[model samples]
Target chain A: MVHVGANPGRSGHRLSAQAARIVFDTRQGLAELFGVSDSRQIVFTSNATAGLNIALHGMLGPRDHVVTTSMEHNSVMRPLRHLARERGVRITVVAADREGRVDPAAIREALEPKTRLVAINHGSNVVGCIQPIAQIKEAIGKVPLLVDAAQTAGSYPISIERDGIDLLAFSGHKSLLGPAGTGGLYVRPELDLPPLVRGGTGSRSESDQQPDFRPDKYESGTLNTCGIAGLGAGVRFILERGVETIHNHEMNLLDVFLERLRRIEGVVLYGPSSTEARLPTVSLNVEGKSPSQVGGLLDKRHDIMVRVGLHCAPDAHRTIGTFPDGTVRFSAGALNTTDEMEQAVAAVDEIARS
Target chain B: MSSGKHVVLAFDSIHDVIKAEKIIVRHGIWCDLIPTPRELSSDCGMSIECRTDDLPDLESLRENGALEWRDIHRPE
Candidate 1:
């Protein structure tokens, strides 16, 4: 495909009219994907981190208290920590099980009357363990729920309204297959969030004051129009492929990889042993081998791309007993193939033997 | 595809197409946006096509800062 701008905001005169239509249709498609109403509830951001910041800053104040889990990416954890340290907002981090899963009952026990928000990651980026968000939401009662869906948005089915999620943050690049610098937050229409950024949205040009709306309220300055434009294309691609098929393919690959990893004598896997309860992302360390060493061998020797280190989630690493040194991460996508997984398994087996 | 008429629109940027789409849809018009057809000029790679009768809606779109308007079937 030619590299066309997916950006509806900056297509200018050539596509001045149609660009807007594309974005509208794209939002409708996304709303259907998430089983939500009114595309207006979705606000575009530069990335998932930006969406998290918007949700965190918009919903909570100095006197509020927040509840989160240890398996969060820095996008969620760092902002909450900052809020606690600087603004005097109170936060409680519920610990996760060794498999990196947060028990919903633990979260319920951590809640207080002053709790304003409950933030949780839908899936652990390090171990790929999926959280029990529905149960957590049930336990939260009236408190608002924010789900960090960076690793699970397109890879799995997420229904914001049906699941009782007040806010959701996702990245376009990871599984949505769009360019970087594109992501969004889905805020339920009822919650009134403060504007995170203030400037031109081209909608309220007549007034000096910024428009108090879902997207325009948060979206300030010129948007990453080109990135979002590509995101439209990426979203269309995923919709056409069907989310269920994609999930099945990923789980099948994970199944094969996990079975092979288990057969290897010295390899130690993290997270749930079964593919049924986790994403396709697998983290593991071979006996007598550092994660970086195995990662380098996989890349230099086998020409395979994998992520190593804390995966920007130190708490998740700590929860799974892989902290400090981290572990090799293999995140499968819709485009990943079974043969590739076999090759990856073979490479790991050889490395473990060495 | 012949049952429905298609109109090709060119945009200088992606933002314009996105904005224009929202305006037209609110008026109950349906349109499809695709990578700018290759037979058309290659300046940009996205276009919109919808029923030809929606031309008046096009004027409203232009009033809202939409700049380019072209009939896809116009003879080259």
Candidate 2:
């Protein structure tokens, strides 16, 4: 299907004005999905990494303190590290539980008067544990909360306004089923943020100076229009399918995988065992087998796709006692089926036994 | 399809359209990348069409960042 929003700024002529309205409607739909008041609050980016960078660099400066969890993807961790190294920002990493879950009290204890931003990953990429963001926001009191929702956005229901999230970064490619390089940020209207990239926004093309706006300020150069359109299609697909149904489907798969893996001897699973407190992703290590070995075997022998290694969250792996070596990650999605999970379980059983 | 009269252009970056036109003319594909018209809703600002049969190779172009595809027909 032809994607929506593929010709955003350039669409003044090609499509009838009514077709263009679909783009606006898609943005509005996104706003409603995230529980934001205005669609203007949503700014599109090339990817979630860019959105995270924008949120980190735009809102932080020298001597500003930020609190984050150990389970963050590199999208959040790398930027904070850069800020600390170059801009003199202080960052405190709140430790997670043995199951890779971050406790709100731990985040509260890490906070200080200088803490300007409290950033956390909604769902861990390595262990699939879901952080208690509402509790963390409550503990933060007044600090602006920035959530990296790269793995959770379309897969789970989110309400940025209701949850007190000041900024949210999400990826369109993963759970959203959009094309890669499509992501966005939801910034609260009241926050004062510096522009990450400044250039022409098509609205005021004649003016050399950048427009002082939420999206135009952050979005520099031309956008990935086709990717955004695909993202819109993906989002609409998810909205129609229902986030709760997607969540249930993934959770059911997770339950089956966990139960099957737990029954096997010498197989170790990380993160919460219960489906209620986690995403559908599961990370596990088979005794006497490295993650790379298992991942290779699964792909080469079984034609199954799985991610292995640090999964870009070293601290999370460390929290779950899988650091350095990492674990094999099987991330279930709306497209995944019970048969696939069974096939994966059988593959794991074979690999573990051999 | 006209005999050797068509051209195909694939682009990863919109900026690559300039390069694609030069290469197409050099190889004699008789095609060029133009700013996407209103009828074609593609992500990038440019599209290429030399022949309808070139559509089968669209996935190859996608690997280079051509997120959308369109066919251009020159009015005889």
Candidate 3:
């Protein structure tokens, strides 16, 4: 609010020079986090959904073929589904295994000559399994890869160039620790996708036609300058602390939490075993109780916060064979203490015994 | 002698000039956000100025994609 208040343009009409600097800094910081050279490749959006939409809408058209995965959240899936129905875009969904793992070979096999893009997620929200994106890139030679990094951006390390990702979309609120309604998409410099919106950019004001450039090409109208300032702060915090350090800390805590919880009888843990490099998210069910019931018990009785239900990834739940009744999701953030893990594990164990 | 040979960094907008200042300063060089000299640039209202001695550091920052500078000048 202060950023917007200090700046004249709330909806992007007349922005004070200060807010623009923060926006650029925010993009540059994110680029550094992604291990990319140019921050100009980073474009802001309302959220990852909007970012994904910008990529899809800009890249996909009638009869354009796209290859995606079953483990995708509705953000990617729904957009593709709509494109298929409304725009005649053909889609091939690579099936995930019972463990919610997609075989890169399957994705490679699904690709056809007409395929315009290949979309996949870096991590699964439900199963918490990390995908080998680089291997998948190797499988699909030169097929532009669009990654949904919503679950993995801040919690893990991603290198756009190293990973061979063409376009990457990520949410700011989840792992970036920024305010909601803030996120961005990174498009490789050589690649140009159509703008999501075309409006005032304070550039080429002489002509009504929107300027075709990097940030101006994609970002039209006023942006969430305040949120972006906050997002820049969030990225700086990650940078100063180190992404790998935070990731390692979260994984270690998850290890301790899983070690304690999975051993309890009647506790049904979902997703990959502790052997895999996964997010700190753990989903489980108490044998005789509902997920919501167990979640409530953890919250009310143990003062633990967790997300329960489908987690906006129905296909992921179905892949794990939990359809209507979802698992209780316990996500350990960067700040979670070892004691909190123990208390959460003890809470689940007590609930399981009851 | 090199102090007179300064780099001129211009942008498309004042906000971008401000962004350039932040990026340059963060990289450890002191840059003055001055009014864009008409002779140096027709880009934005503001530009960044740094001593020519910092050229290598500026080059490294540019290589790292610190900011996309429009033009640079060295006056005799």
Indicate which candidate wins on lDDT: 3
Model 2, span A1-354: residue lDDT tens: 253434444433344222334545556668877888767788888888998998899888889999998888888889899999999999999888888888898898998888889999998888788888888899888899999999999888898988889999998899988899888898888998887878755434445776665455676766776676678888888889988899998999888888888998888888887988679988989999999999999999999989999988888888888879999999999998889999999999999999
For model 1, residues B1-76, the per-residue Cα lDDT tens digits are 2344556665433444565555667668887666565455522345666676776677666777643443353212
TM-score of chain B of 1: 0.66
| Residue A115 Cα positional deviation in candidate 1, in Å, after optimal superposition | 0.2
TM-score of chain A, all candidates: 0.96, 0.95, 0.95
How do the residues A245-268 of candidate 1 rate in per-residue lDDT, one tens digit apiece? 899989999988898889999999
Of 1 and 2, the candidate ahead on DockQ is: 1
Instruction: For candidate 1, report its TM-score.
Output: 0.82
In the range B1-76, model 2's lDDT, one tens digit per residue, is 2344444443322323433444444544455344454443322345455654443454455456533323343323
Write one digit per residue (lDDT tens) for candidate 3, span A1-354.
463444412222234556666787788899999989867788889999999998998788889999988789999988888999999999988888877778899999999988989999889888788888999999998889999999998889999988889999999998898999999899988786888788876554546676666776787777888898888889999999988999999989989988888689998888888737689988888888988998898889988889899998888888888888999998988888999899888888889888
- Sorting all predicted structures by TM-score, with the top scorer first, yields 3, 1, 2
Note the Cα lDDT for every prediction shown: 0.80, 0.76, 0.82
Model 3 spans with C-alpha error above 4 angstroms:
A1-4, A8-15, B1-10, B13-16, B22-76
Pairs clashing within candidate 2: A4-A229, A14-B38, A226-B43
lDDT of 3 by residue, B36-75 (tens): 5556534444566788788788888778876667677665
